[model samples]
Target: MNLDNILYWFNEVFSSLIFIYMLFVILVYSLMLVFAFLQLRKDRNLDKNLEGKVNLNAVYSKPVSIIVPAYNEEIGIISTVQSLLTLEYPQYEIVIVNDGSKDSTLQTVIDVFQMEPVFRTVQNQLPSAEIRGIYQSKLHYNIVLVDKENGGKADALNAGINVSRFPYFCSIDGDSILSTKSLLQVMKPIVSSNGKVIAAGGSVRIANGSEIEYGSVLKSVVPNNPIVVMQIIEYLRAFYMGRIGLSRFNLLLIISGAFSVFSKEYTIKVGGYNKNTIGEDMELVVRLHNYLLKNKIKKSIEFIPDPVCWTEAPDNLKDLKTQRRRWHQGLLSSLMLNRGMLLNPKYKQIGLISVPYFVFIELIGPIVELLGYIYVILSFVIGNIYLESALTLFVLFLIYSTVISMFSILLEAWSMGTYPRIRDSVKLLLYSLSEVFWFRPLMVVFRLQGFWYFIRGKNDWGSLTRSGLQKKTNDTL
Candidate 1:
């Protein structure tokens, strides 16, 4: 064949491959959506029935240790602690780990909670950075503070784990606020399952424009910023469609670090969190799965959609880009490190389905989608291409992106019943429709950069600025 004919054939084949990939993605996404919808419906009904029957003050409820790891979270630590103090769970203690912040993070906690330094021995099951001291709150007996040398989030969590007194320890971000019933709801599955559920994750909602009262979100408002709005939609789609479906099959690999309850014994046995990777949350969950499968333990990691943890989302483009890139990098790192589990029958569903989905659909999805975009442009420029078929595929992709996003938003509205204002729901729907045109492409570029950074051996956490949760009252918890 001549050069022109070969080039033409290459374009056609590439375009055909892209079309097939899009079709597969759409099919998988539709399946996930169906699974998610059924799960959400079931959970909603279960929650409704349990609300009247289940007693919050039941004697059998297990105590949890809430761990807040702070690096430079001076601005939001106090409010976060306040939110923790108000949890409706029967029993829990707050342990805030100060990871040697250059800012006055430790001092702020000490002053606010009237912490007194005390010499106490820790189990130190997990290896971590050096500990400076441990403190107990003079005002609140249940609260404890750990002063530790500079370590990343994972190290700080491990340090917290050493000091935690409860069997289950929950990791909460310093900039996050949990609803009053969040802990109770998240722990419900574990309690009901009789230790069959090893870990449970709660839904994380963006708190950019929401009105907060004493560290509790009083109203859930969709932020006016285009980026924040896009992220709000993204979170709904991920948690509702992606996580819920994955968790149903016992194939969930990631439970958000922002608010997740984990069994302390299992966490320590699995070597706590991996300090080396930025995606410690995901890495730890995957490790837990690996450990359970190896030992033939019949425990599960669950995602509880009703327990909401409000978190601050990056409003500016720079901060948002940094966050997305770092997240993608962490995801890539976790998958690479656990490559042994991929297609390994010993791990069952996680190896056969979850890992492959993450590798092909989650990890390389951005590259493929980006290539699809490039192919469309090239086909247009090169004229004698299959124009009609190309346009049809493009339309399918557009519908797959925007329509699925809209459905996710609607699912959130139907299931969670948050964003009560009809106007807010409409706004989210409109923003989700625009995702295919602008926000998705931008995220695609950011994720691609994250892959590049990983390949180039660049390790940067990037900048994350917090505006602090809005407080309606200055009341102390």
Candidate 2:
């Protein structure tokens, strides 16, 4: 065959493959939408029944040790600590791991909380960086701080784990603030499961434009920044549509590290967080799944939709890029490390459904989608595309992006009633509709950069500047 014929054949094959992949993705997403709707409805009804029925401070509830790993988080650490102090739970201790931040993060906590040095012995169950000293807050006897050498987040978490004294442990990022009842709500599934659920994650909301008073979100307002507004919609889609459905089937692969509770015994048995990977949260969760399948253990990891942890979202382009790249890198690291469980029969639904979904749909989906975009441009330039078919696919992709995102926002408004303001809801809907044209593509580029960085062996946790979430009047810290 001539060169023209060969080129034509290659283009045809590529177009066919892209179409098939797009169809597969759309079908899967549609199924997820159904599953998510059902799960959300069920959860809402259950919440109604359980309202005022169970006491969160009951004797049967297990005590939790809240571990916060702080590194260069002086801006928000005080607010985080204050929030933990006000948790509605009956019995819990707060362990803050100071990961040798160059700033005055440790000193600020020490001075504000009136912390005094103490010699507390740790069991050293997990390997971690050297500990310089440990301090207990004079104001709050249960609040402890571990000043440690400059270790990464994972190592810091391991140090916290070593110092923690409880059957269950909860990890929260230094810049995050949990709702007063977040701990109670997140622990509900674990308590109801009778210890069969080893880990549980709560929903994380964007706190960019929200009013914060001593770590609690006073009034949740949609940010005017288009980037932040888009992120709010993104969070809604991820938590309401993706996680809830995944958790319903006991196939949850990741519990967000921003706010998650784990069984101390099980985490220690699985060797704690992997210090080498940037995605320690995801890696640890996957490892837990692997260990359970290998040992034929009957336990689960869950995602609770009501428990809300408000976190700061990237508002600018540069910061957003860095965050997305790091997240994608972490995801790739987790999936690659657990590649053996991709289709293994012993792992059941996890290996068969979740692994394949992450590998094909989550990991490679970006590359395929990018290629499709390029193909569209080339086809239009060459004037060889079928207009009708192209238009249909384009509409489908738009629906996948805008419509689904809008649905998620609507679901949140209907069930959770997060954004009480009708204006905020309308603004969120408008931003979701525009996400496909700009924000989504930009994220794809950032994620692709992350993939490239991973391949080039670049290990850097990009800088993140936090505008501390504290009301001006309440900024005493």
Candidate 3:
């Protein structure tokens, strides 16, 4: 056969495969979007009715321990703690674990909260690194600070778990700020589920370019920065189309550590967070599922769409790439560690469905998508009928990003009303539609690098620079 003929046939097979794969992905996303919409429509009046009937201040409500793990978080730790102090829940204690920050994270927290060195016994219920000292806040009596050795985030969380004195604990990142009602809303499912829901998490919104005062989001505005705006779209897609749909049937595996609540009993039973992995939050959720499915226990982990955690997003491409790479790496590590559950009939939906979905779609998706982009570039060089195939594939990519992302943005607006301005929504709509051309390709490359890191046996908490959430800024969308 001629070389040109061989090239044509090879491109035919490869382009066909990309078409089929992209079609399957679009179908799945379509189904999830439908589920998400229905779920939101059903719970349309959830916040108002629940607020009217349920009193969060009553003793009948369960108290939660808010765990803030800090490592070089001097820039944002105090603000995070202050935000938690304003939680509208009936009772909760703030436990901040200072994971041996090289900076003044410990001292900054100490001086700000009027903390004094205190003798407090922290039970080693979960494995953790050694503790240097424990301090209690004099200004806020319920706040306890732990100075521990430099362990990664997962280890620091476990240390906080050991120190927490509540039946359930909420893990909030050092740079995260919660709305006053976030705790109440996130805990609503657990509080109402009659112990059936073991864990629950709320949505997270970018705090960049928003007005903040005293650790509270005084005004909500979309940032004009394209980098931060793209992240907002990504968050919307992940939470609205992904988790909310998965949680409808109890197959949800990943909930953000930045704003998730966990039952101490169940998390402890699963041996706490796995310090060996970069994605401890997801690993813990999957482990909880593994324990439940294997033991035939009837329980669920959930994602509540009502509450939102305001956290800072990296405002530059370099930092954004680092964060995305670390996230993708963590995802790969978690899935590989739990490969036993993949398509195993014994584990039912989690094994047969959720695990495989993440493995095939979420984990290796970037590689395939990268190949699709390559095929597009090569088709032009190879010309003729291949151009038709390339054009079709390009349109498919456009639909895959634009339709799904636009729906997510609309869902965010309909469900949360986060951005009141019409132009902000218009900006998000335009960017979501344009993502496949630029932002999506960049993510494809970055995530592939993350997959590479996982193969090389590298797991580390990547560094992220944070401006304190309370700092005033105006970058209008």
Give TM-scores for every candidate, taking all chains together and pairing residue i with residue i: 0.96, 0.96, 0.98
- Model 1 misplacement above 4 A: 47-55, 58-61, 471-477
lDDT of each residue in 1-477, candidate 2, tens digit only: 998888778877877788888888878877777888888788777754255247564524699999999999999999999989888888999999999999999999999999999988898999999999999999999999999998799999999999988899999999999988898888887887788999999999988888888878888888788888899999998899889888889888988999999999999999999998899999999999999999999999999898899998887999999998998898898898899999988899999999998889888877987887777666666665444445656676787788889989998998898889999999989888788788888888988987998898786878887888866322111
Kindly list the per-residue Cα lDDT of model 3 for residues 1-477, writing each as its tens digit.
999899889987988899999999999999999999999988885666467246564424578899999888998887788888887777889999999899999999999999999997788989999999999988898999999999889999999999998999999999999998888888877877777999999999999989988889988888889999999999999999999999999988899999999999999999999989998999999999999988899999999988889999999888888888999999988998999999999999999999999999998899999999998998888788899999999999988998889999999899778988888888899889779999999999889889788888877557877777868887874
Total clashes for model 1: 0
Residue 135 CA displacement from its true place in model 1, Å: 1.3
Best by lDDT: 3
Clashing pairs for model 1 are none
Error of 3 at 242 (Å): 0.9
**Ten-residue stretch with the least lDDT total in model 1:** 468-477
Q: Give the alpha-carbon lDDT of every model.
A: 0.88, 0.87, 0.90
Mind sharing the TM-score for model 1? 0.96
Greater TM-score among 1 and 3 belongs to: 3
Error of 2 at 278 (Å): 0.2
